[model samples]
Target: MYYSTDYSSPIGEILIVSDGEAIVGLWFYAQKYFMAGIDDTVPDDDLPIFKKVKKFLDDYFNGLNPRIDFRLEPKGSEFRKKVWKILMEIPYGETLTYGEIASKISSKMSAQAVGGAVGHNPISILIPCHRVVGTNGKLTGYAAGLDKKKELLKIEKILS
Candidate 1:
């Protein structure tokens, strides 16, 4: 069973999901691929992982960079998992282009492929997929909407 809870963030209402022990998903309400791989969810705000995530988000919104040390179990393919791992390495308040991530992960992988994996990330803010930009430094392809992406970047002081 997947335990879940709701977080009212500056961006919007976010639904956080967990598989009892570790977080499995965190999706911006109605965002693209919302609840993509989840099933049999039960709302439980008191879950331990939910509480940790809430604190992490609170610190993030308060302009403090919180470490992502909590357990996470995002469901995805091996390639997507590799991409998400790279996403986690993106420093707070910094951005990387899809091409850059592709090169870091595998020379054979295309930027377009990396973009697809980034877009499909199950956990949104926690994975920091918003820290990715286009090759020309243009904000693009955020599953949670470009406006929210820009807002997150601005909150992190990456954008003015």
Candidate 2:
């Protein structure tokens, strides 16, 4: 089960969904409402993970570098996990091209494939999928939208 909370942010209102321990989703309202068919069920309230995740989000929105020490058990295939792991390694205030990540993970796969996997990433900001950009340095398909992506990059000081 998942529990959700709404937070007002500089960019927009965000809906945070968690499974008591790990945040399952943190989506901007516009993007979230656009995909209306998906379920938004909240899990039980007694889980410690929910409180930890909520605190992390609070610190994050307050411009504090809060350490997110929770385990992220995102649902995905092995290849997707590999791509997500590479994304996590992308330090804050930095960006990487899909081709770069693909080459780093396995030169055999195409960069486009890596981009597709990234696009489908369930955990957004926490997974840092927005950190991935075009090889030419242009922002690409961010699930939360490109404008939000640009805003997040600017907030993180990676877009200056």
Candidate 3:
């Protein structure tokens, strides 16, 4: 069964979901694809994983550059999973362009396809999708909206 808890972050309310052990979803309230793969959940709030995630988020919002110490099970197609794995490689305070990610996948992989995968990423901040920019290094197409994206980047010190 899926368990959930709400976390209040600097940006907004975030719903954190877990399939008992691994983190399955974390999304800003009302953001695109919020709880996309979750069907139902019991609001537990006391799970160990939830505690760890809350602490991670706490350090993250406080500019501590917290490490991803918990297990993640973001559900998606194989292609999207590949893209998210690449997204995790994006260092904090750095950004990668869609074209760059496409090239890593294949010389011929379209930037648009990479964009789609990034857009569907279920675990937002932890997955680092906000670190993706357009070809011109301009911020664009965050599922949580540009404002949240900008705030997250600012937290990562990527934006002044």
Candidate 4:
């Protein structure tokens, strides 16, 4: 079974999903691919994971880089997981180009491929996919929309 809750964030309303024990997804309301591949969830505002995620987000938006220790079980293939792992390594107030992520993973992987994986990241802010940018440092390819992406980066002080 799946549990779900909503968080009112500075950027917008967010829908957080959990598989009882670990968070599986967190999407901005109406985001592109919102809740993609998720199914049969019940409202569960009291899930411990949701509360922890809320606190994590609260700290992040409040200009604190709180250590993230909550369990996450985002569903995806090996390649996507690899990309998401690199995304997690991006510092709280830093950004990386899609090509940079591709080169880190494999010389054979193209920036387009990395961008595709980043675009599909289910955990959003927690995974830090919003930190990926164009090679020239222009923001791009956020499933939650670029404006929201900019807001998140700005909150992190990555964008002035």
Candidate 5:
């Protein structure tokens, strides 16, 4: 069963889901692919994981680089999980093109395929999917809307 809670963030209302321990999903309300891998959920605003995620969002909006102390268990294909892990390595104020991510995975990997994985990222800001861009540093689609992605980059000082 999934334990869930809601958090009001600067970008939007986010639903944070956990298995009572590890965070399994977090998405902006009504975002594309929101809760893509989750079901059988019930709200529990006081779940410890929810409290930690709330604090993380609080510190993030307050411009603090809060450490990810709580556990995360985002569900996805192995390829997608690998892509998300590389996204986590992107520095706070930097960006990586989808092609770059593809190269990291395999020179044989296509940017479009990487884009697919990037676009399906369920954890959003915590997984740093906003840091992924198009070639030549152009803005591209984001599951939570490009506007939210831009706002997040602005907060990261990657965009001004």
Candidate 6:
């Protein structure tokens, strides 16, 4: 079952979702889907993975490179999973464009396809989709909202 909890952060409120075992999503408060079709109730349990996600997020907000050790099952196609795995290789405090990621993963893949996979990332921060930017080094699409994207980039010290 999917459980959710609300957390207040420096950037904004966040909705944390877990499958009772692993956190599945971490969405910003301003996201339209944050309040849509989601059970906002969290069960009273010793959710270790959920707690880890919260802690990682807290450390990230505190300007620390959070050591997150949690399993994630991001729902997507094989190509999408390949893209997300490449995204994970992008070290923290660094940025890459879609074309760069595509080249790193497979020279045959197109930048537009890479961007599409990045946009479809369901696990958000865990997969580090925010690390991808426009080829021109400009901020680009983020499902949680562009403002939150900019905040994440800034917090990770990847943005000016």
Candidate topping lDDT:
3
> What is candidate 5's lDDT per residue for 89-134, written digit by digit as tens?
9988889999999999998999999999999988989999999999
lDDT of 3 by residue, 1-160 (tens): 9999999998899999999989999999999988897899999989999999999999999998899888999999999999999999999999999999999999989999999999999998999999999978898989989999999999988998
The candidate with the higher lDDT, 1 or 2, is 1
What is the Cα-based TM-score of model 5?
0.97
Tens digit of per-residue lDDT, candidate 1, span 56-131: 9999988899987789888999999999999999999999999999999878879999999999999999999999
Give the alpha-carbon lDDT of every model.
0.92, 0.76, 0.95, 0.91, 0.91, 0.79
Model 4 residue 128 lDDT score: 92
Stretches off by above 4 angstroms in model 6 are 30-46
Per-model TM-score on C-alpha atoms: 0.97, 0.84, 0.98, 0.97, 0.97, 0.86
Q: List the residue pairs that clash in candidate 1.
A: none
- What are the root-mean-square deviations of the candidates from the true structure over C-alphas? 0.8, 2.7, 0.6, 0.8, 0.8, 2.5
lDDT of 6 at 41: 59
How many Å off is the CA of 37 in candidate 3? 1.9
- List model 6 lDDT by residue over 1-160, tens digit each: 6777767888787777777776666677655445443555566335677677888878888999877688776656899889988988888999899999889877797999998888877676778999999978988889888888988899888876
Give residue 54's error in model 5 in angstroms.
0.8
Q: Is candidate 3 or candidate 5 better by TM-score?
A: 3
Q: So what's the TM-score on candidate 2?
A: 0.84
What's the C-alpha lDDT at position 93 in model 6?
A: 95
Rate residue 30 of model 1 by lDDT. 86
On lDDT, the stronger of 1 and 6 is 1
The global Cα lDDT (0 to 1) of model 4 is: 0.91
What's the count of clashing pairs in each model shown?
0, 7, 0, 0, 0, 0
Distance (Å) between predicted and true CA of 5, model 1? 0.2
